[model samples]
Target chain A: MKLVPLGDRVVLKQLVAEETTKSGIVLPGQSKEKPQQAEVIAVGPGGVVEGKEVKMEVKVGDQVIYSKYAGTEVKLDEDEYIIVKQNDILAVIQ
Target chain B: MKLVPLGDRVVLKQLVAEETTKSGIVLPGQSKEKPQQAEVIAVGPGGVVEGKEVKMEVKVGDQVIYSKYAGTEVKLDEDEYIIVKQNDILAVIQ
Candidate 1:
């Protein structure tokens, strides 16, 4: 199923969480940190907001870092996706 | 001390948290929610970020809503401020 994000919103598939520390033994699922990186799947066409032209900066295929507690998680077709406003995204990894 | 935010970052002074619900009985400070609204105090110059020309959308004096879990909090001269990237700002209240 395709995901279509609405205004200033985006859909992202999370990157894998880190399972090991510097010492090299893998940690359990319960000890894995929340993933902050993700690949953009879809982006909304930003429009007018409060008399300002909201611009969509990040596009599909861009890998981004987002706020940990900022997005809503959804499961569709057994795949997990995160939906978040553009503002919650911290940066686009080059 | 004067605050000068770095590229695409903004300095904001938080708005007061609600002391009570609609019914109007004052609540304790510990029960107050984290403030989501803030007045812009300073704005950073728009600059290049990740090969993209990052533009500053909100100006000084705009009241903005930011991600609740985002931003770095700092205190100077007995004043508290939140420093956040432009993307962490959700909306400007016009």
Candidate 2:
């Protein structure tokens, strides 16, 4: 089943540390700390959420750095995902 | 210094556990878990925050129940307070 997030939530697939960084440095997956990087898989519609008017800034396929302790982890069809609000995303990787 | 929260943030003074519960259960202050109830000390001027428009619902003197793990603990003038987003507040006690 496909998971569709509501409001300003964005579904992300965590990018393992082995991915290349913006500075062209390739990190090893065996790194001690988990990376905060992820690729956006789905983005909620930008609209009013919880009495606030939110605008989704990240789109699907965007690589982003999110807050470490933000979002909820969900497992869908054996695939793990992290769903967070747009405000939790810190930056977009080039 | 007086803390003036910005953009949907609320400054709250946590009510001690000794306060009475909704059903009139008088809890002892020695309870192990910290109480999640607080009194609204200051309300932010809600407006556009992180590109979202927010409206403040709670006002000063309102007793509120907030998320257990939400908000930042702050100390001002030797008095402790919790700085939380308006959304973190779950309910207002009558």
Candidate 3:
């Protein structure tokens, strides 16, 4: 399903948590923990301020680092997705 | 600890999760679940584009709604904090 964010919010499909341990030990699927990373899939037009539109700084396909404890979890078409404002994004991975 | 975000990032101190059930049954401290909410404490100056500076839209003390699964969790002087880009913020709750 196509997920669209309202206003200046963006919808992100989370990147899967790592499956292997630091030592390269692969854990079973049942025991894998969720990864705290995501990929930007959709973005809103720039936020509006006093009748002027602020352009978005990030674009689709930017890999960003975010806080692990932010954002509300939503299940869209059985796929887990996250919605956050453009301002909440920390940094784009180069 | 005072957190200064780099660039257009912000540091948020999470609000405590609710302690009472929908029926008003107060859960014990040991059994309380973490709430998916936070308060804006600090923000970065606007992001830079082409060496020009932009101003931040949100300010300190704004209650914002965010995604459940965004941001990096950090421990600052024993307090838990989340760091995310300003863009990741969803909306300001008035």
Candidate 4:
């Protein structure tokens, strides 16, 4: 929770991929696709461009959707984290 | 330039892949890699999360880096555009 992101970036903890559908049938882990959902832990301080300031729109504690293929993956304390630009986020879950 | 992206999305015009290096030696056009750099054409109205409004950080005309494999590709009037979430964008060119 103490990680400080820079320049409109976000630190996310990806949700675990689901193995069971709503129908209650258990599925093999291999059949489940990677999860695009994540929980926001840290937010960037924003950046500047052409004399204009670009501020972070995502905040801490937001549940967001992101591109599975985007972002750099990292591991700390056996927990996975992904560092992505704010642009890579698809949506914030209400 | 008139496209209105939705929900933290952006409209990007991908830069052409380089076939020639600064030394002027040219690679076959077929062998050139796809470019991940793009020019921002339009930006979405940011969405809401947890009763807070998320605002756009990227603006039009930003030359940005992005994930090559992300976004939806579309063509209008022979111009190609990629609609990507804001998080898919990596960096803005200064």
Candidate 5:
């Protein structure tokens, strides 16, 4: 079953990190810090949340940077996703 | 300087835990779990926060139950306090 986050939550899928060296050697990101970048997968319908009126700013397919240590990780049908409040998202990349 | 919270933030002072048993024996609450209860010391004037319009709900001198681990602890003038969002407060005690 797919996750349907409530309130100002947004579903995000982390982008795979691939670093290319100057000589064009590709390296896995296993030894590096976990990237804070993710792609928006699902957007929650914005309305009132916790006594506040929230407006959804990010749409699906938008690349976003989220706060570290934010969101809950969920695994659904062999796919993993992070569910975070829209406020936890720091910025959208282009 | 006294703390003045911003946005929907609330400054709380933890209530001194004094439990009196049926036998009239006063007991300190240090052996038990940290109390989630606090007294509202300051309330922010709510407005637009993180692109959402928030309305202040709790007021100063109100006793509240806040979510555990949901606030930032600060020391001001040797007094410890917690600063939390209005959403972190679960209920106001009558």
Candidate 6:
């Protein structure tokens, strides 16, 4: 979907939770908590700095690791998404 | 209680949740969710920046706003606390 971030917030598309268990048992979504993994789809240019410009360190399409409980949840067009700031991001996976 | 931050992590002392409602009705802890406000107690020097020094913007004793679900929970001496990186901090309230 065409989702745009507001201000310094970024939109993340969550990755699906693991379905197969170590023993090869398949678990359905109703039986497990949602995983926190995500793929970056959009990001703000950067946060404002003293009326100056500050470019962002991360770009779109980067896989990132973030706090499972971090960011505010939002649902757009029946799709779940998260809104987090750059500072809330822990690290980016190459 | 004395707490120390490791690496780029910071320690925060949580603020007490409001007891009185907007209409002055008293809500007890068991009936309400914990508030997410905190006062900074300690901070790491800074995150690694190309092996160079980068001082932290927030300082000790600064009141901060953070994600309600951010950080790992830890209990020291029966007191619950959170361990979060500097990046997890949203903003410092001056």
* Best-matching candidate per TM-score: 1
Q: What is the DockQ for all candidates, taken in turn?
A: 0.04, 0.04, 0.06, 0.04, 0.04, 0.04
Put down candidate 4 lDDT per residue, A10-94, tens digits, no spaces: 8998654534333222223332223355689888887663344566776789776565556888887778789987766755545
Residue-wise lDDT of candidate 4 within B1-94, one digit each (tens)?
2345546788889765534455323345454333377799888787652234667788999988776444665433346566777878888988
RMSD of 6: 11.7
Per-residue accuracy of model 5 over A61-87 as CA lDDT, tens digit each: 999877635455543435656667899
Candidate 4: segments with Cα more than 4 A from true spot: A18-35, A49-52, B1-94
Put down candidate 3 lDDT per residue, B1-94, tens digits, no spaces.
Answer: 5888877677887764534333212223322222244688899876573354545766888766444345888898878888876656665544
Query: lDDT per model, in order?
Result: 0.67, 0.70, 0.60, 0.65, 0.68, 0.57
**Poorest lDDT segment (10 consecutive residues) of candidate 6 chain A:** A24-33
User: What is the number of backbone collisions in each predicted candidate, taken in the order shown?
Assistant: 0, 0, 33, 10, 0, 0
Task: Estimate, for each residue in A1-77, the C-alpha lDDT of model 1 and write its tens digit.
Answer: 88898777899988645443332122234312232557899998878644445677778898765654568999999
iRMSD of all candidate structures: 13.1, 13.7, 10.5, 13.3, 15.5, 12.9
Residue B32 accuracy (lDDT) in model 5? 28
What digit string (tens of lDDT, one per residue) describes model 6 on residues B1-94?
3444534667777765534445322445564333355788677556443333456777888888665443654333355455566667787766
| True-structure Cα RMSD, model 1 | 11.7
> Per-residue alpha-carbon lDDT of model 2 for A22-77, expressed as tens digits?
75435556765334888998886757776567888889999987763556554433
Candidate 2: tens digits of C-alpha lDDT, residues B21-84? 4432233343333336678999999998887777677799987655545689898888999999
Off by over 4 Å in 3: A1-7, A10-94, B18-35, B49-54
Q: Candidate 4 at residue B80, lDDT? A: 53
Task: Using DockQ, give the best candidate's number.
Answer: 3
Model 3 TM-score relative to the real fold: 0.43
Query: Least accurate stretch of 10 residues (summed lDDT) in model 2 chain A?
Result: A68-77
